[model samples]
Target: MLGALNMGAFFALVYVAAQLLRTSVAATIMAVSPVAMMLIAWPLLAERPKPLPLAGAGLGLVGVVLLVASGSGGVNPLGVAASAAAMGLSAFGHVLTKRWGATAHVLSVTSWQLVAGGLVLLVAAVLVEGAPPRVGLPAVLGFGYVSVVATALAFSVWFTGLRHLDAGTVGLLGLLNPVTGVLLGTAVAGEVLTGRQLVGLALVLAGVLLGQPALTRRWAARRAARVAEVSPGSADHPGSSTVDSRVPVE
Candidate 1:
């Protein structure tokens, strides 16, 4: 279950997001994942939210509404449900990883989850889809790329990043994954980026940026400064970058 949630979330979300919202819009939606993680962790892990991250989450909500409402198309129920499921599962998986392997090596965690998830998925596929897929060169290439680059390298880099930076910082950086997807879809798939989509995408990015540690700190410091200013005799503390953001589990 955990493994399925971890690996399957990425594949399922990407496909559905691309189909429902186009590649770029889908990527923008994914940029809001950190916000989702924070929310999920709140109820599950007793986490709290920082002001900037909350603002970013709000921005994500707006962006989602605008993007879905743009043009003749409103929100597609199936698409929204699939995307939400993908994100929710991803968030749950992350929390479980943190809880299950608080002291375990990231590689070990990755390996165990991948194996369990693969087996579960394979069994599910055999039961529902009814047959193994024909292995072709293109399929092989796709599998190789996802396994080597997306899975292995991504987790390695992520675990390393967790060592140095805060979760908000690392999470913000992870948004680059969706950005690459959006760009590639535009260049390779010839997907059109409409005016409304551009605007919605902008909102999504702005939200993600707001949720980053640096920006969140900037906002926090500014608020603190303002509070100090308004008060008669308060200590001045500039460059205090602590927000109420949740720390990543090791």
Candidate 2:
């Protein structure tokens, strides 16, 4: 079920989104996934995002819109709806993983989910797309990279994140996926990165950083320490007050 929703449905709807909408528009709509994940997590995981992170998620959305709009592409209403559906399905899958796999080992959970999704994709490919025309060296290497590094290792970390962090926080990190994708396209796929894309990337980074609890805590602690040092109120010590709010207590 997790695979069906997250892997299978996610990919399937992506195809649907592509067919219904322009590629850029599809990507833009899919970019709303973090917000979708947040909404899904609210009831599924009983998770509520902080105010700043919520705003950050909204900012990320704005970035995605800019990124897509900056590109030259046609748009469609149905495509927008399809992309939204894909985003919702993706978010739903993430929430389910966090909820149902709460106690499961990350490797085990990710493995099973990927297997299920792979099986479904395999069946779909055989039925609809037919056999591969050719498995050339580049195609084989690409497949291996996506299957191993992208799916196995990457999703392992993602599943681990779902286990440890609130869904909203982890979901916000997903915005980085597009940043990586866009940068990769520019670096390897011969795609151009427009000013809008750069702005979008910046917004996404700012949003994701804001959504990090550990980072926020450290900032707060540092701010408190600065205040203590400047205010001259030695609440914990004779000369100065030390407030350690960093995660891991390091």
Candidate 3:
């Protein structure tokens, strides 16, 4: 089931949507997956969504919307539906993986999921598209890169992250997908970055930074220090020496 949701169905639906929708549009739709994952993880993994990360996710989502709004074309209903399903399934699968709690090695778990999903995708392809078409050397190389670098290596790191990070934090990091896409278009495709896109990029970066565990912890610590300083019996308080202790001291 994990394999089906994350690997097979998610990839299949994404391909289907990509055929009918613009890349920016599809990517923007997929950007909501982090929020979905956070919600799913709340109940399934008993991981409560922290306020800072939730706020950052909201900010990042807004940034993604701005990044795509200019380039998004007319929406195809089927494509939109497919994209939404892919997002939901992937989020569910990710949260489920987290819920399972890293019982096995990350590589071992990733490999098994890939193999199971690959088999299902292979059978489906044979049925729907008949025999595989012959491809040039370039195409074979591209496939090799995707299989090795994109799927195998990428998923290994992703699962490792899930084991160590809060689901909400991991989800917020996924906002980078669309950010990378937009930046790649500017750099690789020679597309000009508009002012709105620049602002969106900044917001997305800010959001990612805010959701980082270290930053969140620092902010929490600062807030706690402030509270302690203002409290009557705190050491930093001027009147603290006047306050009597409730418990007997040695």
Tell me the deviation in Å of residue 61 in model 3: 1.0
How many clashes in each structure? Answer: 0, 0, 0
Model 1 C-alpha lDDT per residue in residues 1-250, reported as the tens digit of each score: 6678887554556566668764434544565677777766667655567877777766755655455443344556677667767766776677656556667787887787778777876776688789876899999999999888878788766665554444444555555454455457679999876676567667767877887777777887999988887564533334444443567646
- Name the better of 1 and 3 by lDDT: 3
C-alpha TM-scores of all predictions:
0.69, 0.78, 0.88
All models: lDDT?
A: 0.65, 0.81, 0.86
Which of 1 and 3 is the better model by TM-score? 3
Q: Candidate 3, residues 1-250: lDDT per residue as tens digits?
A: 8889889998999999999888777877887887898899888988877778888888888898888775435789999999999999999999888777479888888988899889889999999999999999999999999999999999988989999998888888888888888889888999999899888888888888888899888988999989988898886678787645776777
Q: Per-residue lDDT tens digits of candidate 2, residues 1-250?
A: 8898888877887787778776667766777777788887888777765676788789887776766665465677777776787788778888898888988888999999899998998899899988869788999999999889987999899989888888888888877767787888899989998887889889988888888988767877888888776674665555655564663554
**Highest TM-score: which candidate?**
3
Q: Per TM-score, what order, best first?
A: 3, 2, 1
Instruction: Using lDDT, give the best candidate's number.
Output: 3
